[model samples]
Target: MKNKPNQLKYLKYQKNRNKGFSCRRNFLIFGNYGLKSINSGFLNFKQIEAARKTLVHNLGKNNKILIRIFPDKVLTKKPLEVRMGKGKGAIHDWVAVIKPGIIIFEVKYKDYDIIKKAFFCASQKLSIKTEICYE
Candidate 1:
């Protein structure tokens, strides 16, 4: 994928500014670190909602899964209201906080990069291992 000129410049600046900055921070996966494949809403609600349910219902072989529902878009760190769907529905880019003792699995249909960032970010913050499970 071609990089946007402005985004490229900003990334370059960040790279130069933080020489000692390590990619590991407790274990926070910054999903918005890079460009996304189209947008979250671009995908069909049915498909997205199905994926969300699969994440929660499947859970893990042993680890407990906790799904966070956001009311609106959250681009950065800030206390915000998140909405959880009743049955089968989409959680608009919801940030699922996989608590301690639970290995987080970030599931994505197409956005590998976004999933990776989220996985990494979660890993950094939660001090737990995070894995990317692509659908």
Candidate 2:
């Protein structure tokens, strides 16, 4: 079955900069490579899962990959031909409201080249722009 969130507390949010790079107290505390978001947008769980799968499949089990963001915010939608007067919509999917400078993924390994290759595959799965950062 396709992945879907079982429940969500709310449907809409304030779209404020409530979280960002400043909140990550240990952004570089564990990884050598960080996947930083260059744009702000909602990232679906499926997209993150696909990117993570690509990283693990290419990098194998020796290295460690950490997913920093999560798809917690609920995004609702209506049917294609539905009437316009309905109340908002039902919960259709879940996503993470990513902001600029937020680290989406962190990779830790000894080989920089391998890290770059793995990140390259993963980066293609995202919709918004991203940048590779190292420490």
Candidate 3:
């Protein structure tokens, strides 16, 4: 058996060699984060409205955001299963495209919540700084 340090080195080498840019860590984190949103019931109309209000209050009255709420499958254009191999799979949640650079997301919900989740997720991921009003 290899020593602990040797094992760690071998693992790192394997990750860098094979996985390289095709890593699923980000998607995994996204999935878990999404589960938290679901368990906590964060995907609700009121929460969405609050998010919208927050964006409007902060971004001002002129900023307009295009929001699209759909299944993670639709969002990623891939399967929603993380273990599907190779493919990053769909976002499995909401998808918000803020133009330029930003993709807000949520991994659950199949209704209006998707729209809201996408906007919020994109804003957070992109660090938009300003508010994302979806009105």
Candidate 4:
């Protein structure tokens, strides 16, 4: 599924300088288990989709999966060997600015071992380190 915002107030945003730990979405809310990020980074849409697919493939269809993060920030890139002083580059990708202690994915399942394994596989597809958390 596409995870980008349909409309944004600003087309491009400034570089992300917010390094503070995420205060919101740090706790499990919708599910019994979750994958919490350990480091701060930008998660692109492809990585997010890969992780989601891995989770779904490992967990099967009966389980419920909730994606906590969305790629709202736009990343731009200049064409190869482009001249300087050409303003901002065109939008190349979308990413989610993630911070430490943020819950990236949540799952509601009865089996702990299965959930752990699925989360492990999903974490492997992500760019940041993640630990499985349960409530």
Candidate 5:
């Protein structure tokens, strides 16, 4: 771990910012990777981090994991005891609009069985549908 990039891309750019850029990565780097995201929905930054934590724990110190998507869109939520017909809710949390084909995460490990457990734990932390895949 010599040089790790700490840059996080700006989001809240949900309005007409679709320039057809490839946010969802199709190809993978390692042989054993955890393929995720079958359905489309909002994925928060916390979810991404939690999933990565699980992957790292399972992969140990040798393997690598990549997070393919980022949460750029903002989500709103209404407070409790709020009346109806409100204009809009308050800004709650940030999220990325994940699609069906978008790959959320990819991981590589020696033990294949542990990979499944890692992905399963990660998927449980997420709010959308996800699957584990390999090379």
Candidate 6:
């Protein structure tokens, strides 16, 4: 599923400069195991979808997966070989401004080994480094 919001207060947003650790959503709340990010960056919808697909495919359909972050930030991109001074380009994609120590994905499962393996495969699809944390 796409992670974009249906409506927003404003369309475009400025580039994020805050790189500090996350104060909220740093701990597990919805599930027993979670995938926590170790670095700060932007997570696009495609990357999120890939990771989610991997998790679901590997973990089976019975397990429940909860995504903590949403790609609500709008990203603009100018067309290639275009001249400057045309305001901001058209909206391109949506992304989530991720901070260190923020949990990305949470899963409720019985087997620890299977959960670890699924998380490892999912982490490879993301741009940021991640570690599995458990409650």
| Candidate number achieving the greatest TM-score relative to the actual structure | 4
Global lDDT of each candidate:
0.31, 0.79, 0.31, 0.92, 0.68, 0.94
Q: Weakest 10 consecutive residues, lDDT, candidate 2?
A: 17-26
Identify the runs in model 5 with alpha carbons over 4 angstroms from their true place. Answer: 1-24, 29-31, 78-89
The digit string of per-residue lDDT tens for model 6 on 64-83 reads 99999999998899999999
TM-scores across all candidates? Answer: 0.23, 0.82, 0.25, 0.96, 0.69, 0.95
Candidate 1 lDDT tens digits, 64-110: 33332222221132235555543333323322222222222333234
Q: How high is the lDDT of residue 79 in model 2? A: 85
Angstrom error of the Cα, residue 111, model 1: value is 1.3
Ranking by TM-score: 4, 6, 2, 5, 3, 1
Which predicted model would earn the best lDDT?
6
Candidate 2 global CA lDDT score? 0.79
Looking at model 2, residue 54 earns an lDDT score of 93
Superposed by TM-score, candidate 5 places the C-alpha of residue 113 at a distance from the truth, in angstroms, of 1.5
Per-residue lDDT value at 85 in model 1 = 46
Better of 1 and 5 by TM-score: 5
Error of 3 at 88 (Å): 34
- Point out the higher-scoring one by lDDT: 3 or 6: 6
Task: Mark the regions of model 3 whose C-alpha exceeds 4 Å error after superposition.
Answer: 1-42, 70-102, 105-135
The reply for model 1, stretches above 4 Å from the true place, is 1-109
Candidate 3's residue-wise lDDT over 23-87, tens digit each? Answer: 22123222212211111111323334445455455444554432232211112345444465674
The digit string of per-residue lDDT tens for model 2 on 40-121 reads 7888988999999999998897778888877877767778999889577777787887877888888887788877888888
Q: Give the 10-residue window scoring lowest on summed lDDT in candidate 4.
A: 13-22
Query: How many steric overlaps does candidate 4 have?
Result: 0
User: Which regions in candidate 4 have their CA more than 4 angstroms from the true location?
Assistant: none
